[model samples]
Every structure is written in C-alpha cells, then in structure tokens.
Target: MQGTSYYIPAAAMAAALAFKVPSLVRAWRDPLLRAVCALLAMAGLVFFFAAPPTIAKVNRLTGVTNFSAPLVYALLSGFSASCLVLLVNWRGGPAERTRRISRRWIAGYGVHIVLLVVLFALGDTPVERLRDLDTYYANTPYIREMIVLYLTGVTVAGMTMNFLCWRWALQVHGWLRTGLLIIMLGYTFNTAYGAAKFAAVFARWAGKDWDALSTDLAPILASLGAQISAVGFCLPLVCQRLADTWHIWASYRQLGPLWRELDKIAPAHVRAVGNLWWSSAELSLTRRESDIHDGLLSLHPYFDHDVHARALAAAVAAGTDPEQAQAMADAAMVVSAVRARVADPEGKLLKSSDTAESATAEGTRDLVRISAVLREAPVAAAASGHAAMPESEVH
Candidate 1:
C-alpha cells in the first residue's frame, strides 16, 4: 500500500513529461517550457527513488548498505530546486534578472546535493532501513546532518512556492489564478510531509518511537502533493489548446449548411480545396469557407435584383434587424438564382436585364447568416416558391 502511493504519482509525472517533450523540442529556446519539463522529470525521479521497493533494489544493485539514502536525498534536493526555478520562470521579469536568479538557485542546490552525498559517505549505517531511514538514522554521525539538510531544503522550497503562488494568484484572473491556487494547495501538503518526517525524527532523538509518521504518513502526503502539483502545472497550458480546438471545430460545423448549399452550384472547373482525413480542424475550416465563397461567385450571374429588392423590403417590414434583413435578402436572391440557373442551363439567365449588380455574399459571417435563413426564414421560402413558377404563367 505504501509503495503503491509513490508509484502512482511517479507514473503520473512520467505521463506529464511525455506530453510536454514534443513542445520542449519544438521551442527549444523557450525558458518557461524548459523549466516545466525539468520540473516534471525531477519530480518523477524523486517519487520513484523514494519508494521502499526501489530503495531496496538500489541497495542490492549497488551492494552498499543503505546506499539509496544519499541518492534519494540528492534527488529530493534536485526536485526542490526544480520547483523553485520553475516558479521563477513562470513569474517572469527582465531576462537577465530571471536567468541570474535561476542560476543562483541551481548552484545552491547543486552544492547542497554534493554535501549530502559526502556526509553519507563519511557516516556508517550498516542496517538497511527503507521506510524509517530518517528516524532510524537520526542519531547516526554524518547521516543525521544529511537527513536534516534534505528535509530543510524540501520544506523551505514548499513554503516559498506556496507564498509566491498565493500572492500572484490574488493579482491574476482566469485560468492562471486557478492554477496558482491549486499549486499553493499542493505545496501545503508537501510542507506537511516535511513536518511529519521531522516530528518522527525528533521523537527518535528524545528516546521515543514514532516511526509510523515518517514511514506511513509522510509518503501519503508526498504522493498526494506531487500529483496535485502536476495537475496545477498542466491545467492552464492544456486548457488553452483545448479551447482553441473547440472553437475551430464549432466554426467548421456551423459553416456546414452554407457549404452544402454552395456545393450544388459550384462550377466544375473551380477545383475545390480538398481537406484530407488527417487535416487539422483549423485547416479544414479554412478549406470549407473557401469552397463556399467559390460557389457563391459561380452563382452570381443568375442573381435577380427584383427578387432581392422585394425580399429586403418584406424582411424590414417584418421587423428583422438590419444585419439579418440583409442576410435574408441575400439568401432569397441565392434561392431564385439557383432555380433560374437550373431552369435555363444554357446561360440565358446571364443575359437577362434582371441580373443583380452586386449579388454574392461577402464575408464568412454573412454567408453563415444567409445559409441559416435558407433553411428557416419565411422570406427565403417565399422566394423559392415564387421562382418555381413558369415564366409564361407569370405574365
């Protein structure tokens, strides 16, 4: 149960890294992207190495008693540094200042990791304590110092992250603020993990046994915090891409009516832009709009000014808004034009005096409105019925 807690978050962090690597490679110079990938990688390593099964495996593979101790400590220090550096990049400032601050944190944590390894080498711990290593080695020589260093580093980083995110969250709005609030909550759990471990170690120093706090409680807290923090880091970036894809797909769907209406009159020579199966939503939407416009141009020769004038006056008299009235008028003209072109098939409509001066719909939005009225408006339906009457019967 305890080991499962660590492994779950480890797997989640690995998945987050997989999702981000392509973006990192594409924008190699983006400091913020680099920081995010670094944080995710370091976080995964910390969780994987901190698991008890992994700790025992490392000890066996290296043939050194408790060798996993210094390794896990160094990984924790690295992860702590990564979290702080990522926060620094996320809250941007002047380029030089940001870089300088990031470098300082990296160097400081680099030295701290080295000292942890050196102190572990100097100490003697023949007993392999996987879960309760902090409490177990609390009184050991240099091992004690190594444990203190890692715990302090993680605590300070968690507190600092919570402080920055809370302050920034209060000033921002929308998705960014939501992400920050989640991040702050995650780090609060992390800070509590550090406190739990420290309490267990202190109890050991006072001749008492509270090993469950360090062994059982701390891992649970750390796992929850790490997983929540990963979500907070990813939410804003993922949400934006999702919103863009949704908008593009909706625009494409909304244009379907107009595109189909235009498809009936499209000239065989126009060679419509084809959207391949694997094409992106944005590309497909653009192609559909282009095809609609082409069809509108081909239908222009059949437009009747008399049909447009009557539809426009009737729509206005019916209290339609100006924009919608214009759209209805254009749609009625299209309906009459399509029928005339079908009836005359030999270009007779092009030679008529009733052909409109300006007949084609102009913009994508206007085309959409015209397409909508074709299916719903009474004026367009009336025009369709009137155009179906024979020319000799009208006289």
Candidate 2:
C-alpha cells in the first residue's frame, strides 16, 4: 500500500500532463512548467537507458551510488526554483535584478546536487547484509544515506511550493484557484512522508537501528501520504475540466436572457462583429440569435454610461491597432475616474486570452459591445432604467 502511494503523485503528474497541459499553457503561461515537464521526460530516458547500470551497481551494495539519484530530488528542485522565480517576479520592481535571482536559483540547486553526488560516493554500503531492500542497500551505503537526505529536500521544496500555491489561490477569486490550492495542499502532505522516509534512513546511519522504521510503520505513513498526494495531483486537472464544463453551461444558460435583452432595439450590438466569432475553436457564435451569449459578457465590462461612450468613441476613432484605440479611451476614462475596462501592461485595454491575436480581438469586441448598447439615445436610456422611446417614435 505504501509502495502504491508513492506512485499516486506520479500518476497525478501524468494526468496533468495529459489533461491540464492545454489549459495550463493557456492560463498560467509559465515557461517553468513547460521546462519542468521537459526535464521529466529527459530524466525518464536516462533512468531507463543510461542509469540502469548505476542502479544495478547500487543495488549490489547497501551504502551509496549514482548521479541519477537526483531524479526525485529534481522534482523538488524544479518546484523550489519555480516558486522563487514567481516570488521574485512578484516582488521585484521594474529596476530589480532579474538575472541575479535566476542565477542564484540555478547555482543553489546545482550545489545541492553536487554535494549529494559526492556524499553518495563515500557512504558505507551494506549490500551483502541489506538483502531484499537490505540487499539493495548492501551494495551502496551511499544510496541508503542519500535516500533520507533526498526525501528531506523533497519535503522542503514540496512545503514551499504548496504554500506558494495557497497564497496564489487567495489572490484569484474562482473555482480554478480553489481547486489548484487543494491539489497543492494534498501534494505537500504526501511529500512529507517521502521526506520522513529519508529522515528515517538518515537516523539509521547515525545509529544502526533500521527496524525502528520498517515496512509496518513506514508503509502506513507512506500510504496516507500517497493518498493525499494522489488526490492532490489528479484533482486540479479534473476540477479544471469540470469547471470549464460548468462555465460553458452557465454561459449558455444566460443566453436566453441576453438574447431577450439585446433583441429590444438593434441587432447592431448583436451583429457589430459580423465575421468574428465568440469562440472560433469550440463554439462558433456568428448569429445575433445563435450561440453568441458567451461572447456578450465582454460588453459587461463597459456597461456604465461614461464607459459605454468612451469605448464606443474608441471604436469610432479608426486606428490601425484596435488595442491602441481601446487603450486610448481606457486611458481617458482612467484619468476621469471612470470605472471600466482593465488595461494591460502596454497601457492597452486587454483581456486574459490565450493568444495575442485573441487578446486584441477581445479588447475590440468589448468596446464593440459597448458600442451596441449606446449607438442610440434610446438604448442608453434603457440601460440606465429610463423609459426607452423607440427610434421610429422619436423620429
């Protein structure tokens, strides 16, 4: 059961690669995550092909062995490094030393890995006496000693990563954030076991009492740890998928009301972007009365009178870059203390989109929707709870 538990995180990690990769790429856009996965892939190749001989050698004795031992350590190392990067990025001003933080992280993990290798070479292996696991340990005393050390590292990094995730969850308000934090918590708890197992090994080295931390005590602890980790690993991806489904469902649910509301005066607001879709990939929404409700929410960002006017004015200004046009209006409104349309780093109005092209499109579409709402005086009046006079009646 304990052995099985260790694989839980491995499986969860695998599932995330399979299911959450696309979303992760889309949402987080963290290069470190991609690098981590790539490193895992490379390490797997080495483990199966090159490291077998080293593993065999270590298997022969119960003391120590191999540069390959860093594989598990690598998980924590990458995590620790990534967390530090995020922290640095979060705290650093525009003038802060960006390269310095990165260099420090690399140098730190590298030193740790080197010391571990040297320590592995010089440990007292009990290969002959350590049969079964005892036999494996017998050939490489260094391996035995390092096991506890490596696990401790895992624990330290895991704790740090999980805490970082928890804090991040606090910043973002949504189900996705909650799900990810839960997963992080789970992994942290499980990693503690892996860490403890390593600690136990170290204790044995300090004193020759191996039986004190046996399959009985260790396995149960390991098993419980695995359970937490396994759930943590798998759940974020699962919940993310589930959350997406619910989001789409909720969007569609609001479609009927949106359609009824927009249908009142002009389909101009509805048909402003005649060619563009709400979602070009999954749900193609082109019609005023079709699957377009999902796209309409972008207009919500500019529902207020001043926001609606500025956004529409931005659209009418006729610039080569629609994003720049939105930014122009967004800036004007910000100074006037008008609340609407979030600006991106470039001082352009933007949305959180997967693609650069889409980000601009979202910005343009937002203002367009606002354009729809305020094209005529009656429409603006309706939005503000005034008795809306029909365009023909006014004429």
Candidate 3:
C-alpha cells in the first residue's frame, strides 16, 4: 500500500496525455463531447493519485503486510468520467433509437458501479485463506465484511448492466454496450471471489477447524476479471468510434457547399407556369432543367453514382407508370444539388424567379426548396414511368 502505489499516478497521467490532450482540440468542435472526454481523462488522472491512500487504508484494516487491493477505484473513477462525456451527448427528438440505447447503457452501468462503490465503502476484502500474515495483520474482520457487502452489491448491479447492454446490442451493430457489460463482469466475478473469501474469513473467525477460504483467491480473480471485462468494453467502443469517424469523413468529401450545389441546378427546375399549351421548345427547356438538376445532384458529397443509377432503374421498374419514379429521381437530384450548393461558400450563386416570390434573394436557401423537391427521387417515383422504374426507385 505504501511503497509505489502513489507514484503510479505520475505514470497514469503520462499515459493519459495522448487521450486527454487531443480531446482539447476536439472539444472545440463539439463542446459537449470534448468536455466530457477531457473531464473524464482528468478524473482518470485523479483516480491514480487517490489509489495509494485508499489502498493504504485497506491495508491498515486488513493487517495484511503484502496485501493488494484490486484496481477498482482507479477504473471506476476513469469510467465514471467517461460516462459523463457519453451521457451528455445522448441524442434527442422523435427518432430516439440511439438515445434509448445510450440510456439503457448508462442506467445499467450506473447501478452496478454504485453498488460496487457501496461495497468498497463497507470495507470488502477478497482474502479466503489466512497465513500467519492474516493473524499478524488482523485483516480478516473488515475484509470479510466488505466481501459480503460487495457480493450483494454486484449481484444486483451486474444483472442490471448486463440487461441494458443486451438491449443496446440488439439496436446497433456497435459494442458500446458490450464494453460496459464486460466491465460489469469484472465486478461480478470480483464480487464472487470476495464472497468465497468472505466464507473463508468467517470460518477462520469462528475457529471451528473448518478449512476457511483464503485471501489469495480474491485478488487473482478480481484482477483477471477486471482486466478482461475492461478490455472487452473499451476495445469495442474505440473501434466503433473509429468507424463512425471514418464514415463522416467519407461523406463530407462529396457534399460540398449545399447552396452552391443548389444554385448550379437552380436554373434547370421547370417553372410551374399556369399555361399548359407551351411551345415544344418551351417543354424541352423544362426537360433540360430537370436533367441539369439531376446532374447537379451527382455533385453532392454524400451522393454516389449508384443512387442515381438506382433512381433511373426505378423509372424503368415503374413500367408504363413512370411519372412517379422519374419525378422523384429528378427531385432528389435537385435537393442534393441544392445541399451541395449551400455547402459551398465561394460559388455564392443566387436564386431568382420571374414571380413575386423570386423578387429578392432573401433566405436564398429557401427560394426553390418546395419546387425542387417536387422534381426529385423518392417522391418522384410515380412520375418516372415503368420502363425507367429500376433506375428511379430507391434501393
């Protein structure tokens, strides 16, 4: 408890530098996420520092000379900090799928962690067997008491967290919940070992000649349990984050400025003139506008060539009734084009109309929003006709 436990904080901080420092830069992008991650990192730093004193107290209570306390305090401190980051960023609104997943995870982990802490506060220990050292240290009573507390706490906590983790797994293909469960497992087995040790400690105190459990079993089980669980949870969370970040990056590349993209395709949108008897050339112009809008959509950062082809295919699939599909495809292109245009700053193109609504470029983004939508993908599927259904229908 005394020699080098306190010094480990320095090492912990050094290790945390990579994780905590860059979070400062990231915090600026999303104040909530960065703040949470950074704060947690700092908490992790504090955790290592607090370890020595806490462990020293345990050593005093157990009276075991070469005694060890599982690194639960350090882990819990860091994990709680991380939860702050994750909890703050939970999603909102009607499509509550992601938020629900996170909530389940949070609730599960929170319950288990609280129980674990309470058990520790009650002075749990893992020692099952007494050596001469146990007699000398007088570690049995308090340690045994803690074991009983921990077992009760973990039984409740682990089950709750595990269920939440299971729910999250069902919703998404990520391991955020998995990671949490793994860590919870650490508490589970650690508690089990402590429970076993509790029986041992109790038997020894009774002095009935029954073979009591020993302290040796508790620490080994706790350490291995914690390590495996923590790694199980952390590895997946890290991997999931990496994958999500990569997807965002890839999507950002093609989108460009949404306004600029819109402007590029703006002129192509057919003006909904009241008169139906327009000249053939006029009708052709409307068609040209539709084509340009569709082309502009291809410029969108997130748009892939496959989407365009699929829209075209839908038109064919619609058979003789292609209007819906074609119109939808065209409208989708217009919308994508508009988004790309808006995303661009340098183009700064404007939208104007020959009507009263087109007078000034105010709220420029809204100029043809409704009309453009009428000309594009999902919605226009009915307009594209059956021959082109395959290309126009959304996959």
Candidate 4:
C-alpha cells in the first residue's frame, strides 16, 4: 500500500510537469507558471526519493549509510518552499512584497536544508535501514534531533499552507475557490502526517514504542496528502479550460438558426475554411459568425423598419422583458430580411441604419441573444410571412 501510494503521486506529478512543459516554454517569463512547474518538479523529487528502493540505492551509491534520509528531508524542505513561493506568485500582490516574501521563504528553507545536512553528517548509522531509519535512530543523539527538526519544519510549512489556502478560499469564487478548499484539505492531512511522526518520536523519548506511527501510518498520510494536493493545484486550470470549450460549443449550437437562414439567402458569402466535421468549436463559431455578417451585409436592402416595429410590439405584448423584446425584434428583422432577399435579389437597396450596423457587428452579445430569439420566437414566424409577400401585395 505504501509503495502504491508513493508511485501514484510520483506518476501524477511527472504527468503534470509534462503537461505544463509546453506552456512553460511558450511563456518562460510567467512567474506563476514557472512556480507551478518548480513545485511539481520538487514534489516529484520528494516522492521519488521517499520510496524505499530508491533510498537504498542512494545510500549504496553515496557510501554513507542512510544518506537518503537527509536527501529526502532536503527535497521535502525544498518542496515546501516551492509551495509557499507558488502561492505567493499565484495570489499576486505588490511585486516588491511578493519578491520579499518569496526570498524569506527560500532563505528559511535553505537553513532547514543546511541543518538537515549537518545533522546527517554528525550522526553515525552503519546499518542502511531505508524504511526504518527513524525507529532505528530513535534514541541516538544527533539522529533524534535531526528527525525532530525535519518534522518541525514540515509541520510549520503544512500549517501555514493550510491557513493560507483556507483564508483565500473564502475570498474567491467558482473553481478557484473549490480548488483552494481541496488544497486546504490536503494540507490538513499533511499536518496530521507531521503530528503522527512527532508523536512517535516523543514516544521514543518517553521510553515507549509507537514506531508504527512514523514507520507505517505517517507515510500513508504523506502519500495521500501529496497526491490530493497535486490534483487540487491542477483542478482550476483543467476546469476553466473545460468551461471555455463548453461555452464555445453552446454558442455555436445556439447560433445555428440565424446562421442557416442567412446562408440560404446568401450562400456565396460562406467561406470554406476547413472540414466542417473536424473543425474545433471555436474555429467553427468564428467562421459561422463571419459568414453571418457577410450574409447580413448582402441583405441590407431587404431590411424593413415596419417589420421590426411590429415584431417589437408583438414581443412586448407577449410580456417579454424590454431587453429580450429588443433582441426578438432584431431576430425578426434578420429572418424577414433573409426571406425578402431570397424573394427578390434585385430589390432596391435600403440605406444603412443603426439596426443594420448592429446586426452586422462582429461577435456582439446582442447578436447571440437575437440568434437565440430566432430559434424560438413567434415574432420570427410573423416576420417571415410578411417577407414572403410580394411588394405589390403587401399594404
């Protein structure tokens, strides 16, 4: 179970780093992205080194028994520092204050790193007990202090992160807030991991054996916390991208009625850009909007002011809100114009009006609303009937 836990987070952090590499390369100057990449790298290192097989290999290679102990501690200290810096960069306050806070965290963690190295050097452990190092050296002088110091530093960092995430979660909204709350939960587990380890060490000092807390239980907590934290950090970015894609696809589908009507009247205006079946929603929507504008421009001569006025009155009589009624009226005018253009392509050109200008405007919210009205409004059917009549037959 411990092995599985370690490998899972290690794989996840590696995948996250791989996913962000392209963005990091494209925006190398983006401090927040750079911080995120660094955090993932450090987290990956922590999990990679925490595995017992890796620890034994490192101890064997370094010719110092249990060298992986200090190495893992140092990597974990660096990971904590990276998390703090990433948070600072992400929150984004005054530039000078951010730099100062980041510098202080780095310096403080640097001291922890130095302390870990010095204590590891001072301790004497001939046996390479990769998994049971803490229990083995529970009573040893320098080794005991070394374990306690690392635990203290980890606990402090975890507590600070939990507080920061919880406080910030209250101020944000949407996926960001949800992500922060998840991060806080992860950090809560991290703090528990530290507390468990500390309890084991304190038990040793009090002449009791609670070794399982450090040797077995704490590691599980660490692994669970690390994996959850990685997912939490990634959640907002992934969710936001999904949301944007959904909005684009929704807009494309909503604009279908308006796009199809205009295309029938002015098929020549449609520009073939790519395979319609394979095109992305954003690209398809952009092309559809461009084609709609061109088609509307071609039908400007068929725009009837009286048709628009009557549609507005009808929409109002139906108890639609003023803003929505306006959109319905605009949609009615567009449908009527398309029918008139098809009925008589050589009809006299109507002079440019505000309605024409607004109808043809690129990527406006009003256009989307009007497109929706065209899909379901009764005013559109009435306007189509008026447009279907010949000029001599209409009053």
Give the best candidate by lDDT: 1
Q: Cα deviation of 384 in candidate 4 (Å)?
A: 2.5
Instruction: Sum up the clashes in candidate 3.
Output: 94
Model 1 has an lDDT value of 0.82
Q: lDDT (CA) for every model shown?
A: 0.82, 0.45, 0.44, 0.81
Candidate 1 global Cα RMSD: 4.6
Task: Judge candidate 3 at residue 239 and give its lDDT.
Answer: 87
Top-TM-score structure, candidate number:
4
Candidate 4 C-alpha RMSD relative to the actual structure: 3.5
What is the overall TM-score of model 2 with all chains considered together?
Answer: 0.47
- Candidate 2 per-residue lDDT over residues 36-66, each given as its tens digit: 4543343233223222343455544633333
Error of 2 at 80 (Å): 5.6
What's the best-to-worst order under TM-score? 4, 1, 2, 3
- Clash pairs of candidate 4? 301-350
Cα RMSDs of all predictions? 4.6, 13.2, 14.3, 3.5
User: For model 1, how does the per-residue alpha-carbon lDDT over 1-395 read when each residue is reduced to its tens digit?
Assistant: 46787787789889989998999999999999999999989998988998889999999999999999999989989999999899899989999999999999999999999999999999999999988889989999999999999999999999999998998998988888888999988999999999999999999999999989988888888877887887888787788789899999887877776676666666665545456789998899888888876666666776666777777887798898999988877777777776666666665555554544334534333766777777675655675664443453222
